[model samples]
Target: MLLPTLTLLTCFLLIVTLLPISNHTHWLIRGLDFPRLQIAIAAILLLIFQLIVLEITRPSSLLLICVSGFCLFWQSWWIVPYTPLFPREVKRAEKNSQKPSLKILTANVLTPNRNSQALISLVKQHKPDVLVTLESDQWWQNQLSVLEDDMPYTIKCPLDNLYGMHVYSRLPLTETETCYLVEDGVPSMHASVRLSDRVRVRVHFLHPSPPSPTENPESQERDAELIVVAKSIADSAQPIVVTGDLNDVAWSETTRLFRKISGLLDPRIGRGMFNTFHADYPFIRWPLDHLFHSEHFTVKSIKRMPSIGSDHFPLLTTLVFSPKAIPENEGIDASAEDRSRADEIVEKENVSKSEIPQPTAHAK
Candidate 1:
């Protein structure tokens, strides 16, 4: 009885592990892309159990073992890049480097959660150069007003919908725009941040809706929104940083394609999966919040902040704009196939191709 039960369970796990490889946009299929880490762990433990408890004397048992091994390998292939075993995609900044550094604090302040002061305290302690809050409604905007004096440059879009977003930056900003890329209610922020007198960086903040029955029925809008952003910054010559709650894992096909198309590198590669969502459930968490940057920048420090009474624990990252380090770190380039795939994804959705006017930048 035990052997038959184990075989059935292992086969089911294999099916779930392989489902995300399909390009289908159904919420169920796309949703599987978020839990590769947990699946891999389960697969390995099952393999160990079978090896010690169940003797592989029969041919069917041998085949099951082989299939289980393959399932584990497939999941690991997608998730191993974020572990320390893989090579670092973004180089670490030298302690003596004199490059200009920018610190950014990004959080998704669950719109319904009324814990405004908790988030404000994190801002005070970290003192980031930029602050990005998603799922922020008018109430959240009013509550976060105290940060304006410290972070003068601002772009605010306080909507009742969960898609609301705000950007507060200490540095000077130019060419700033609040764009609605896919859905009218959903918004994204684009701006050129003046890091120093001689250096400027292009930054994008995004919080696309996820593939869920409650929010979005399919992942089309989320995938297209990301591709649209990727196409916009693919050929940028200046330093670039894209950060926010992407609502997708770093290893998902959509996100990997976004990296190739935009030529941006993920700092989490080889460091760790800085899982920030579901702050209350430690075991069920995955990396839904992300920060990706150009090769011209090197990581100074990156960490997940403590919970602030929201579903996502904030992410704080410090990156140094070191143009000299460009030769050492190369951005992921899109192949002809990748470019074709991205174009197809965008073509399927009726995306807002036009750029919007700059929002009123609030000042103290």
Candidate 2:
């Protein structure tokens, strides 16, 4: 009974592990992209059990071992880059380096979780130069207004629809715009943040909807919005930083393509996974919040902040402006085929004029 049960479980795991390879936009398949780590761990345990219990000389035992081994390898290929086992994609800041630095703190806030003071206390402790809050409604805006005296520059988009976003910064902001690229009621921010007299960086804050039964049945809108942003960044010559709860894992196919097309570097690569979601569940967690930037910057520090009454733990990252380091820190680049894939993704979404949201009012 035990052998048959173990064999059945191993087969099921193998099937689920291969599902994310499909390009289908259905939530069931796309959602599988989030748990590659969990699946990989399960595969490891199954492989060990098979070796100890199963007769190695039997043909059935050999086949199971081969298939399980293949599944482990595939999952590791995607996850290993985010572990310390791989080389750091974004180099760390020098101990005595005195360069222009910018600190950003982003949290999802869960919309319904009302413990605003928890997040407020975290802000006071870290004092990030820029603070990004998602799922923030009118109530959250009021509660966070106390932070305005220090973070004077502000952009607010309060909505009850659970996609509202706000940006508060101590540094000056210019050429700021609120955008709804793929769907109305869902907003993203674009701005030029002045880090120093000689240094200014293009920053984008995005909180795209996730692929799920309650939120979105398909991943088309999420993937299209990301591709649109990547194509625009590819044409720019300025230093950049893009951050938010992208709702997709760093190792997912769409995000990999995004990095390739935009030529941006992920700080989490080679540092750690820094899993941020499912804060309430210890066993089920993955890195959902992210910060991706241009090679003009190097990582000073990156960490997952303590919970603030949200499903996602806040992500705090400090980056130093170091354009001279670009040559050493090469970003992921796209091939002609990759560009074609990005174009196809954008074209398939077919966003209509009516879907475009009107300009939202801001607190300035």
Per-candidate alpha-carbon RMSD to the true structure: 3.1, 3.7
TM-score between candidate 1 and the true structure:
0.95
Per-residue lDDT value at 7 in model 2 = 76
- In TM-score terms, candidate 2 sits at 0.95
For model 2, residues 37-100, the per-residue Cα lDDT tens digits are 9999999999999999898899888888888899999999999999999999998887778988
| Candidate 2 least-lDDT 10 residues | 355-364
Give me the displacement of residue 194 in model 1, in angstroms. Answer: 0.5
lDDT of model 2 at position 116:
98
Error of 2 at 287 (Å): 0.9
Model 1 lDDT-worst window of ten: 355-364
- Residues 1-364 of candidate 1: C-alpha lDDT, one tens digit per residue: 9878888988898889878888789999999998888898888998888887776998777777888889899999999999899899889999977878999999999999899999899999989999999999999999999999998899999988888999999999888888877888999999888888887888889998889999888999999999888887776675788999999998899999999998999999999999998899988989999999988889999999988888999999999988778888855778999999998898888653344232222111
* Total backbone collisions for each predicted model: 0, 0
Off by over 4 Å in 1: 352-364
